[model samples]
Target chain A: DQQVKQNSPSLSVQEGRISILNCDYTNSMFDYFLWYKKYPAEGPTFLISISSIKDKNEDGRFTVFLNKSAKHLSLHIVPSQPGDSAVYFCAADDTANTGNQFYFGTGTSLTVIP
Target chain B: DVKVTQSSRYLVKRTGEKVFLECVQDMDHENMFWYRQDPGLGLRLIYFSYDVKMKEKGDIPEGYSVSREKKERFSLILESASTNQTSMYLCASRRGGSTYGYTFGSGTRLTVV
Candidate 1:
C-alpha cells in the first residue's frame, strides 16, 4: 500500500506563472514532511519542509502549505521559470519512531514552458 | 558541504553473478540507507544502518542485503543478479539528531542481463 500519494503524474505551466504540486498521506503518524526536486541524471535535492505544528512555511519563491486535518500538503512556486522543470517528490517521516524511516510519493513531473 | 558518493554511475552484470554497490558519506552521519527507484514505483527503501555493524531491513529487502562495517561506508549486495533488479539505486545519509532530512548520492543504475 502506498502511504503517500501524488495523484498528478505530470503538470504543465507557462513561464512566469504559478506552479502548484499537491500530495496526500494516509498515515497520521507522520509528523514531518519534505519536498525534494530531482533533475535528469542527478539525485533528489531538498526543497522545503513543514512540521505538523505549522500551517505554512516559505523560502523565497518556494512555499509549502500543510493541512494537518486533511493530511495534505502542497508546494507552490510563483513566477515559475524553465529551470524549475523537474520531478518533485513528497516525503514524510514519523519522528516518534527511533528508526527515522521515511516514505516517498510516486512523484510529480512538472514542466515549465518558456 | 555534505557529500554522499556512490562508487559507480552504471553497471552491467549477468544472472547469477554477485554485485556490490558501495556508498560513502563525508559528513560522518550515523544513519545511512539504501533505496531502489523503478519506473512508477518511485523510491523504496531496501535497508538501513544506524551504527557500525548494525543493519535493518526496510520495505523491500527480499533479494538484497546490506553491510555497514564502518561509520562512513554502506554497501548493498545482490546475491544473485536478476533482470527485475535492474533499476536505479540510491544511497543517503543524515545526521543523528539533525532536524533536516537526508543527503543523497547521484545514484547507480544497474542492469542485469
Candidate 2:
C-alpha cells in the first residue's frame, strides 16, 4: 500500500512564475512533512519542511503548506528559476515508530522553462 | 557540512552475482537507511539501522540485507543480483531524535544484467 502519493508525474512552468507541486498521504500518524529536490544524477537535497501543527512554512522563495484535515500538502516555488528544475519528492515522517521511517511519494519532475 | 558518501556512482553486475553497496556518513548520524528508487514506484526502503549492529526491515527487504558495524557506515548487500533489482540506490542518514530531514548521498545506479 502506498501511503504517500504524488498524483502528477511532471510539471512545467515558465521562469519567474509560481510552481506548485502537490502531495497526498493516507496515514494520519505522520507528523512531519518535507520536500526534496533531485537533479539528474545527484542525490536529493532538502528544500523545505512543515510540521503538522502548522499550516505553512516558508523559506525565501520556497514554501510548504500542509492541510492535515485533507491529508494533503503542497510545495510552492515563487519566481521559479531554471536552476529549480528537478525531481521533487514529498516525504512524511512517522516518528511514532522506533525506526522513524519516512514514506516518500512517487516524485514530480518540475521543469522551469526559460 | 554534513555528508553522506556512496562508494560507487554506477555499478554493473551479472545476474546471480552477489553485490555490495557501501555508504558512510560523516555526520555520525545514528539512523542510516538504504532506499532504491524506481520510476513510478518512488523510493522504497530496503533496510535501515538506528544503531550499530541493529537493523530493521523496511517496506521492501526480500532480496536485500544490510549491515551497520559502526554508527557512520551502512552497507547494503544483495544475496543474488537479479535484473529486476536494477535501480538507483540511495543512502541517507539522519540524527537521532530529530524530526528534521535526512541527508542523502549522491546515489548509486546499479544495473544487473
Backbone clashes, each candidate: 0, 0
| Candidates, DockQ | 0.74, 0.83
For model 2, what is the C-alpha lDDT against the true structure?
0.94
Q: What is candidate 1's lDDT per residue for B1-113, written digit by digit as tens?
A: 77999999999999999999999999989999999988678889999999999999999999998999999999999999999999999999988765679899999999999
Spell out the clash pairs found in candidate 1.
Answer: none
Quote the lDDT for B27 in model 1.
94
Worst 10 residues of 2 chain A by lDDT: A93-102
lDDT per residue for candidate 1 within A18-54, as digits (tens), equals: 9999999999999999999988768889999999999
Instruction: Kindly report which residue stretches of model 2 are placed more than 4 angstroms away from their true locations once superposed.
Output: none
Mind giving the per-residue lDDT tens digits that candidate 2 earns over A1-114? 999999999999999999999999999999999999999778999999999889999999999999999999999999899999999999998877667778999999999999
The lDDT leader among the candidates is: 2
Q: What is the interface RMSD of each candidate, in Å?
A: 1.0, 0.8
Writing each residue's lDDT as its tens digit, candidate 2 over B43-106 gives 9999999999999999999999999998889999999999999999999999888988899999
